[model samples]
Target: MRRSGQNRFPEVDALRGCAVVMMLLYHMLFDLVFFGNLKMNLFSPFWRGYVLSGASLFVGLAGLSLTLSFSRERKHRNVVPFSKYLKRGLLLLFYGMVITLVTYLALPESYVRFGVLHCIGTSVILAYPFIPRPWLSLLGGLGSIVAGYFLSLKIFPFSFLLFLGLKPPRFSTLDYFPLFPWFGVVLLGIFAGNFLYPGGERGFTLPNIPAFPFRGLAFLGRHSLTIYLFHQPVILGLLFLLGLIRFPL
Candidate 1:
């Protein structure tokens, strides 16, 4: 999704593609376990860290991309509108809601109420004010992380606030990413983007190397959202065809 007249950053796209690969691996493992084809503890420390790392890469890149877009837009138009972010956020949220609906019908006991899409969408909208202020973004990001640590220690009774890092005891979900700590990752990415790509131009130098090696990953990154929406179904279908999983009658 390159903006008009904006420089394309293949590195960013490749990194995002790498994260997408990680996500695909994680989901494949999860499906294997869920279908009784594998016996592993996904909640173990190692797996938890794996999940966090992948999510951080995705969310952080989102923030960084937002800053780059904002910088370019500001340069071109002399003013960046909030409506761009609003429309994008709403689109992602709508996609998240569609996932929620599908999951609710497929697995009512554990549907994704607020998954990565929801978090990223909400963060995109929330991070707009801090886009031009790197220092404030750093502070806000760190503060959110600290606050999330404390917030996770207690359980709130209200289910309506689940997206805000508050939840009742035993609240189970297949995928969950609340704002607190996760939003911090996005802010940090914003800070990094502003610092690294000031005025929408690269602030550092790199050797002029060919992009051939990264072509595949960059392609994956460019179409990440579409892949994310369809990968699970494809995986499940393959597993079913191989007799690795069975659909409930």
Candidate 2:
């Protein structure tokens, strides 16, 4: 039931590309504030909503992409191996650990302990059972979201559980996306993926839109992981070169 000779979905990639643009803009503003050039409040209502929306787009897309991958694999093998997900998840987690190390060295006070990469990696592993069950995924996703709300209300003393949405009092991070709500978002994406792209085929009609306009965005989306890994450094370097920020000698 796959699309004829088309392995990738341009629409999905374009949407992900849009999210990447949003992320870049948000991080640029955040870096400005970090460098003392801006006094804006990112925790304010507008910025908070913006951040949440951008994160949702990324996480949800990851979930949807998982379903497509699973279906595609199923076509080739009788039993999809858990090792496939395991390896992928571990690779992402490894990348996340690298970020953790870099940020800890650079900004120990508010370093990322378990950011979006960690969350996505863990979600990919945990979501294996839920991919084929849309109804269960829906319930699980909503439950996780509700549970996250409750978890955020209380602060625990244990720092080890930070990845699971438990926070110590006064905990701060430049980036953080624990499993509860964010993983729930992934599950919801999985649910939507199953419903919208059952057996890796589009369930709805899409217009024959021109590819030229979307080519750039699609390219960005395809290389999003690399962009995410490098964007901050590039942005900071640009700011430094522009004389907007000076190195502390």
Pick the TM-score winner: 2
lDDT of each: 0.88, 0.90
- TM-scores for all candidates: the values are 0.94, 0.95
Per the 3 Å backbone cut-off, how many clashing residue pairs does candidate 1 have? 0
**Ten-residue stretch with the least lDDT total in model 1:** 1-10
Candidate 2 regions exceeding 4 Å error are 1-6, 208-213
- The TM-score of candidate 2 is 0.95
lDDT tens per residue, model 2, 1-249: 123236888778877898899999999888888784888898899999998898899899999999999999989998888888889999999999999999999989999899999999999999999988899999999999999999999999889999989999899998899998899999999999998989988889887767665777778888899999999999999988887776665
Q: Give each prediction's root-mean-square deviation over alpha carbons.
A: 2.4, 2.1
Candidate 1 global CA lDDT score: 0.88
Candidate 2, backbone clash total: 0
Q: lDDT per residue, candidate 1, 122-149, as tens digits?
A: 9989899999999999999999989888
Q: Could you tell me the lDDT of residue 110 within candidate 1?
A: 88
